[model samples]
Target: MMILALLGVLALAVGGCVCVVWAERGGPRWVRVVATITLAAGKVVQYSAKNRRRGLGGSNSADD
Candidate 1:
């Protein structure tokens, strides 16, 4: 089950990449929408990882 879930995630990532490329070439409206969603998701994941790393440093304050 875990393997299947991982595969699903991989597929989605690949599809999003494809959509981004297609949107760059002005493929279609749906492609642009998908690309936007994909980019937003990537930003969210990046910020989440940064926050997790900061939390791991044992500092709750953002001054660090």
Candidate 2:
């Protein structure tokens, strides 16, 4: 479950990176800002899960 959660985050990151680069070419300022925030939030959530898996929480291993 943890891995799945992190996978979703990573998938978003990959797709978002592509979109952001494309947006940089011609999209609006808000697109950049929104994408940046979305990417950052995904990363933060992923890291939080990772930390939880490191035994900081009662959660299962990220490998699970």
Best by lDDT: 1
Clashing pairs in 1: none
Across 1-64, the per-residue lDDT of candidate 1 in tens digits comes to 9999999999999999999999999979999999999999999999999989888776746456
Candidate 2 structure quality by residue, lDDT tens digits, 2-28: 999999988977877776786778778
Q: After superposition, how far is residue 41 of candidate 2 from its true place, in Å?
A: 0.1
Q: Rate the local accuracy (lDDT) of all candidates.
A: 0.94, 0.77
What value of lDDT does candidate 1 attain over all alpha carbons? 0.94
Q: What is the C-alpha RMSD of each candidate to the true structure, in Å?
A: 3.5, 7.7
